[model samples]
Target: MVDEFLKWYFSQRPVLASQLGADGHDHTLGDFSAAGLTAREREEECWLDRLSRTETPTLDDAIDRDLVLSHLRGSIAMQSWPEWRRDPSAYLGPVFASMFNPFQQRLKPEPELVAAAISRLAEVPAVLAACRANLDPDLAAPLLVQRGLGQARTGRNFLTRTVPSMVEDPDLRARLAAAAEPAAAAFDDLVTFLEGFTCGGTWRMGEKLYSTLLRERELLGYGAAELHEKGRAAWAELDARMREVALRVNGTQDWRAAMETLMDDHPPTLEDMRAEYEAETLRARDFVRERELVTFPEGEECQVLPSAEYARPILAVAHYLAPPPLSSSRTGVFFVPYTPDGFTPEQVRQRLRTNCRAQMPSIAVHEAYPGHHWHLSYLAAGSRTARKVFRTPYFTEGWALYVEKMLHEQGYFDTPATELAHLDCRIFRAARIVVDTALHCEDMSIEQAEEFMATRASLSPGTAQGEVNRYCAWPTQAPSYLTGAIEIERIKESFTGTPREFHDRIAGSGGLPLGLAEQAALA
Candidate 1:
C-alpha cells in the first residue's frame, strides 16, 4: 500500500552524500520500507503517478489547498534527491526549491494566523541582517553563502505563503495596503522551489495527487489538532516537574524565589559562552561514546559552528546541524547564537554552574553530543524506507530529552552546579508546555504568552519573545520535547529494577513512538 516512488526517492540520499552510509553501514531511510512496499515486482514497477495517487489519511479542514500543494512539493523535490556528500549545491538547491512549490500554502487561514505570519516575515531581513553583520564563525565563505542563499529562498517561500494568506484573511486586507517589500520577498522561496525542484509525478493535480504527498513523502498521519493536543499534555507534566526541581535547587520554601535566584546568574561574553557550551556538549559525546551507551556510527564527527542567520531565530541558543553528507563530509556543526551584552557572562556562568531542578546539562545533552547529532547520525546511516517515511519528532526529541535526565540520574555530573543546570533545562522545557498550550489551544495573545514565559518560565524579554514566535511558527513542537522526555523517564522508571540497563536499551528501540516505547520499556 505504500507509495513505491517515495521509497526510492528517500533511498537516494542527496548529492551532498547519498552514497555515504554511516561508518560504512548503508542506512538509507529506504532501508526500512518507507511505503511498507517490500514486494520486489511492485517496487520495481511503480511510477510517480501511481505512487502519488495512493490514498492517505484525511487532511484537516483547516489545511488549505496550497498547504496540500506544499506537501506535493516536498514529494517532488524529494525524488532524485542528491546526497549531501555527493553534491552540496544540489542538496541546498533542491531543499530550498521545495519551499515554493505552491505546495503547503494554506487555503483558509484564520485572520490571526495571517497577521502573525506577516508581522514575523517583515522582521526576517532586519533580524537576519543584524546576525550576518555581527556573528562570527569558522565555516568557509562558500558554506555561509550557501546558508544565505537558502535563507533568501526560504524568505521567499515565507512571503509566498504568508502574503497570499494575508490577502485572503478578511482582517489583513486593510493592513495589506502597506507592506510591499516583505510581500514581494514572500514569493521568492516559491519561485526557486518551482524552478529548481522537478519530478515526473508533478504532472497531475487532484485530491489523490496532493494527498499522496502528505502520505508518501512525509508519512505524517495526524492532523493539526491531534498534534496540538499531544503537545498540551506534554507541556503540563514538564512544567509540574520543573516547579518541583526549582523548589529543590533553591532549598527554598517558595519556587518563585528559587526561579529568580536561578535566573539572576550573570551572563557571559559570546566566545566564553560558546566555548562553555561546546565543551559541555563534547563531554556529552564522550559520555555516550565512552560508555558505549548507544550505537555510534563511525567516520562522522560533530563540530561546533556559529549559528547561521537563517536558523538563528527559532533554533536553540546552541543548535546542531548535521554534516553535509556522510560520503562527502564528516563534520557536524553546533551553532551558538550571539546576542548583545544583555547576555552577560555572569548569567552564562551561573547557568553553567547552578544546581537546580529543570537544569542545563539536560539541554547540553539534548542539543549536542549523543542527542540530536547522535541520533541523526544513527538514522542517516541506515538505508531504511520506513525510517525515512515514518520518522517521528517525538521519538528523536524524546530520546534527546531522555538522554539528559538519564545521565543525571546515572550520576554523569559530579558537581551540584552542573547537576542544577541539567535540572533547570528540564524546568525550562516544562514551562514550554504552558507557553505552547496557552498560545495555541487557549488562544493566548503574543503579549500574554510572553508574560507567561517570562513570569512562569523565568525567561528574559528577548528569549520570551523568541519563544512566542517559535510557538507560532512551530506550533505543537515545543511540548514534544517535554512529552518525549517524560515518557522516556516513565518507561525507564517502570523498569526500575534495571534502570541503567533499561536506559541503555533505548537506542535499540530505534526511535519508536511512545506507544512502542511502552512496549520497549516493558520488554
Candidate 2:
C-alpha cells in the first residue's frame, strides 16, 4: 500500500521526482510545469477522503503509521487553503525550482541534461499561462503581487543572462536564449496585469484557519493563542540572557548597542564572506566530532557557494540546500549572497554586517554542523522513502534552531560575544513567531510588521521589509523556527539519556513532527 501511494504521489509531482534524483520521469516537468490547480485540489481532497476511510495496514511499523497519518492530514490541510489559487507568488516557487533542479543534481548525461533544460524552458509560457488562468483576480494581495512581479523579473533575468552563460554548447545556448524571450514576455504581461489591479486583498489566514493548520499540518496540540504565549515567554527569556551577555561584554545595559558593536567586526570584502563561512563550518564540524554530539555520515560533504542571482531576492544572507534525499551524492550546498558592486560603501558595510565575525560561528552551527546539513544527511541515510518524501517543516527547522542553543550550552561559543550572537538569532526567531502570527492571524499591516521586526529583532529597515514580505507571501512558515525549537526542547526534557543518544534519536527519526517524534521516542 505504501509503495502504491509513493508511486502515485511521485507521478503527480514530477518536478519533485526530478529533485529527488528519481528516474523514469526525467523527460517531463510534471504537474509543476503547468499545475492544474482546481483539478489538483479536487484530486487531493479525494485522496484524503480515501485515505481516511481506509484501514491502517497491520504490517506497517509504528513510524510508518505515524508518517502516513501525518502526511495525509498535512496534505488535506494544505489543500483546504486556497493560497495557491489566490497568490501568484506561490506559483513562482515551482516554476523557478523546476528550472533550477536540473542544474543541482546531474543524474543524467550532459546531452540529456541540456535537452531537459531546453524542454523545460520551452514549456515556461504554458506554465505561466496556466498560473494566470488559475489565479483569482479578486483574491490577489497587493504585497504578494508586487513581490511576484519582482520574482518574475528575476526569473526573466536568470533565463536570459545567467542560464545561457551556464551552458557550454553553442546550439543549446542559442535555443535557451530563444526560449527565454517568450518566457520574459509572459512575465511582462503578468506584471502589467498585476499592476492594473488595485491592492486591497488581505494576506491574513485568520485565527480559526491558522489554528486548524497548526493542528493538522504541524501536529501541534496547542492553539494559536498558546503558541503566541509560548513565543512571548521564549522571547523574554532570550532577551534577558542577551542583555546579561551584553552587559558583561560592553559594561552597559544596552544589549542592542553591543550587538551593533559585533556587527561592525564583519569581513572586509564580499569575497571574504564565503571564506569565513567555510572556515566556521569546518570548525563547527570539528567541535561536533570532538564532543561526540551525534554520529556523522561517512563521506558527507558541504560546499559554500554564492547565492544565484534569481534566489537573492527571496533568500536570507545565508541559506543551506541539502542534497536530494534519494540522490546518489550526500553533498549539500550552502549559499551566501555577496554584496553587489552597485551598492554604495555604506550599503555594502550594512549588508556584510549580517555575517559579522562573532555571528559566523552561530550561523555555521545553524546552517551546517549539527544543524540543517547534518540533520538532512542523517535523514538521507536512514529515512524510508515515504518518510523522506513527506516532511514537517516544524521538525526540520526546529531541530536546526534547537542545535544552535544546544551547542552553546555545551561551551562551543565560549565567549560572551559569540554567545550574544547565538542569543540574537534566538531572539530573531522568537520575533518571527510574534510577527508571523500577528501578520497572518491578525490585522497587522505590512508596514507595521516591518517596523515591529526592525525594532524588536534588531533588523535594519531593508532587512525587516524583506522578512515581512516573505511572511506575507508564505503564511505560517516564518514562525516554524521558534515554534518547532520550543517543541523540540519540550520533547528533550522528557527523554532520559546521554546528549549523544538524544541527538541521535532525534536525527534518526527523520523529519517527523515533534508530536510524532515524542510518540516514537516513548514507544
Candidate 3:
C-alpha cells in the first residue's frame, strides 16, 4: 500500500522525484507547472479522501504508521491553503527548483544532463502560461507578488547569465539560449503584470486554520497561543543566560553590546569568510566524532560552496542542501552567500557582521556537522522510501536546533563569546515564533514584523527586512525551528537513557513529527 501510494505521489510530482535524487524522470518536469488552481485542489482533495478510506496495514510498526498518517494529514493541511493560487512565489519555487535539481546531482553523464535541462527549459513557456492562468488576481497578496517578481528576475538572470556557462556543448548551448529567451520574456511579462495590480488578498492563515496546521503538519499538541507563550519563555530564558555571559565577558549586564563586540570579530573578507566556515565545519565534525556524540555514517561528507545567484536573494548567510535519500550520492552542499562586488563598504560590513567568528561555529554546527547534514545523512541511509519522501520542518529544523543546545550543554562553546552567540541563535529562533505567529495569526504588518525582529532579536535593519520578507512569503515555516526544538527537548526529558541513546532513538524514527516521534520513541 505504501509503495503504491509513493509511486503515485512521485508520478504526480516528477520534479520532486528529481529533487529527491530519483533517476529516469530527469527528462520531465512535474504536473505542478501545468495544473490549474481548481485542478490542483481537486487532486489534493481526492488524495486526502482516498487516503482517509484506506485502512492502516496490520503489520505496520509504530514508526511506519506514524509516518503514513503524518504524510496524509500534512498533505491535506497544505492543500487547505490556496497559497499556490494566491502566492506567485509558491509557483516560482518549483520553477527555480526544476532547473537547479538536474544540475545539482551527478547521476547522469554531462551530455545527458544537458539534454534533460534543455528538455525542462523548453517547457518554461508553457509552465509560465499555466502559472498566469492559475493565479487569481483577486487573491494575489501584494507583498508576495512583489517578492515573486524579485524571484522571477533572479530566475531570468540565471537563465540568461549563469546557465549557458554550465553547458559545454555548442549545440546544447545554442538550444538553451533559444529556449531561455522566451522564458526570460515570460518572466518580464509576469513582473509587469504583477506590478500593475494592487494586492487585496490576506497573507494571514487566521487562528483557526493556523491551529489546524500545527496539529496536522507538525503534530504538535499546543495551539498558537500556547506556542507563542512557550517561545516567549524560551526567549526570556536565553536572554537571561546571555546577560550572565555578557557580564562574564565584558563586566556589563548588556548582552546586546557584548553580542555587537563579538560580531565585530568577523573575518576581513568574503574569501576568508568561506575559508573560515570550511575550517569550522571540519572542527565540528572532529568534535562530534572524538566525543562520540552521535554515530557518524561512513562516506558522508559536506562541501561548502557559494550560494547560487538565483538563491542568494532569499537565503540567509548559510544554508544546507542534503543529498537526496534515494540517490547514490552521500555528499551534501553547504551554501554560503558571498559578498557581491556591487555592495558598498558599509553593506559589506553589515554582511560580515552576520558571520562573525563567535557565530560561525553555531551556524556551521546547525548547517553541517552534527546538524542538518549529519541528521539527514542518517535518514537517507536508514529510512524507507515513504519516510524519506515525507518530511516536516519541525523534525528537520527542530533536531538541528536541538543539537545546538545539546552541543552547548556538552561544552561545544568553550569561549564566552561563542556561548553568547549560541544563546543569541536560540533567541533569534524564539523571536521567529513570536514574529511568525504575530504576522500571520495576528494583524501584524510587514513593517511591524521588521521592527519587532530588529528590536527584539537584535537583527540589523537590512537583515530584519530580509527575514520579514521571508516570513511574508512563507507563512508558519520560520517558527518551526524553535517549536520543534522545544518539543524534542520535552521528549528527551521523558527518556530514562543516556543522551546518546535518546538521540539514537530520535534519529532512527525518520522524520516524524515531534508528537509522532515521541510516540515512536516511547514505544
Comparing candidate 1 with candidate 2, which one achieves the higher TM-score? 2
Ranking by TM-score: 3, 2, 1
List, residue by residue over 362-383, the lDDT tens digit for candidate 2.
8899889999999888788874
**TM-score against native, each model:** 0.55, 0.94, 0.94
CA lDDT of 389 in candidate 1?
33
For this target, which candidate reaches the highest TM-score against the unseen true structure? 3
Error of 2 at 134 (Å): 2.1
In order, the Cα lDDT scores of the candidates are 0.48, 0.77, 0.78
> Which residue segments of model 1 deviate by more than 4 Å?
1-3, 7-251, 264-267, 290-292, 313-316, 324-330, 340-360, 388-390, 413-416, 490-513, 516-523
Q: What is the number of backbone collisions in each predicted candidate, taken in the order shown?
A: 81, 0, 0
RMSD in Å for all candidates:
16.2, 2.3, 2.1
Q: What is the lDDT of residue 255 in candidate 2?
A: 82
